[model samples]
Target: MVGYFGANLDGAKPLNYDDYLKVPQLINLQECKSTPAHHDEMLFIIIHQTYELWFRLILHECDSAVEAMAKDNVVLAEKQLGRVVEIKRILVQQIHILETMLPSDFLAFRDHLKPASGFQSAQFREVEIVCGLKDERILTAFDDQPEALARLKKRLSSTTLADSFYNLLSRNNFNVSPPPERSQTELWQSWQEKTAKELVRLYLAPSEYYEFYRLAERLIEIDEYTNLWRYHHVRMVERMIGSKIGTGGSDGVAYLQRTLGYKFFPELWLIRSYLT
Candidate 1:
């Protein structure tokens, strides 16, 4: 109704997905029960729809960050990344909402869905791959859809945000190639120290990456929240599904637990230890 009933109905032009997607039609909020899907079908639809909305935000941030990076618009990229961090918090917090459903509630609609799972969400997988969680098993979740699988594959092969930061450090005269673990040579150690200093400079002043630092911290925050979300998800799954595997054949709680070890920015984590 926002477009159809608004005064600017004819004038309001939708330029992007968010700007264009009107309610209900794209939302798909209807109960499957109206068409004999399941008892908890409405709830199921709403949860997934909400998850998609979050993915939209994630995509929006990523698009902005990439564009900013293309222009060497460090400040802009940082701001965009910061927003993503906020979105990450939102994603983590949503686990509570998901947990509200009792085992009985989900079991009512469980059978209505066949093979469809969160693992099948293309956008969510894109977010993971973009952030550099490049495990092949994660990509396997979408093998049924060649298009989704291809896109995920492309992102996995692309440079990640963490890679961007390292490249930036190298550009700024702080030679960071393999990071600390692989950096054993004295020359490498010297460069990493210099790189750390340059990072402080880049993230603190004289460049847009200053904003990028704030943004980087936000990303870290997002990771923390996402881990919390996963933890909560595992707990909820236990309460709801027990030891049963995920809908996409993942090991459910065990799978979620495994994801907790994934890191998007290895350099950022290393900096704290190096600096302190």
Candidate 2:
């Protein structure tokens, strides 16, 4: 009964893999139309869907970290971020899985799909916004989903991961800022601005907080890996689909190109500039 999963103590079945799979709705693969039978259609579905499921997990870990950071719960936030880094490794591995599909194989089923591009993936977009990719133009895709749109708008507008990093730097007594800017840059610029700000702050502060400064640098390393993963995805997709528009209506190659330029934690890299 539904009660079994609903925390009902009575008539509860012991849980194991076999027992769990016996349930009526434990991820039954629905039969959807597969075009031209790419001969590797199952593999294709598995890869993309698995990536999505992984994205969901990524969001779970990253969002928890963001929420923790907001409370200045540094220890808890680090744990959450550690989970995110673990998940990022998994996400990175999937790129290789997708590479298994040759260009010809992808093209066969490509026409079967409409313009339902990854650009329209609200979840991925949220992850970007969380990582400081705050371009207002990217928000138009979710106009139909008012709640999701609203949430992205809020995340874009508020203190993002970059803001949290800045606060972290401030906690350590760094007080840097960039040359006055009239507008905000999304992910890439977000990191740059943060870096630029922190570099100055750390230098200006009267000699102390070295330990806190190290923590900021470590997080920047994590963001660097994340940026690499995102760029790798863009390249992989570009290899498979070329500049042709995504089935999701996004400008395929151009979109990927644009995304490559984003850096989620600018301050880390900016400090590197000051290192020399």
Highest lDDT, which number?
1
TM-score of 1: 0.76
Mind sharing the TM-score for model 2?
A: 0.76
Whole-model Cα lDDT of every candidate shown, in order: 0.67, 0.66
lDDT of 1 by residue, 1-276 (tens): 246534455676536555577654765556484345555666667777888888888877876776666566778878888788777777777777767777877877776565677778888877876665556667766767898888878886776665665665455565454333322457645655665555665454535555556666765765676667777777877888998888777788888778777665544555665543
Query: Residue 142, candidate 1: how far off, in angstroms?
Result: 2.3
| TM per candidate | 0.76, 0.76
Model 1 weakest 10-residue run by lDDT: 175-184
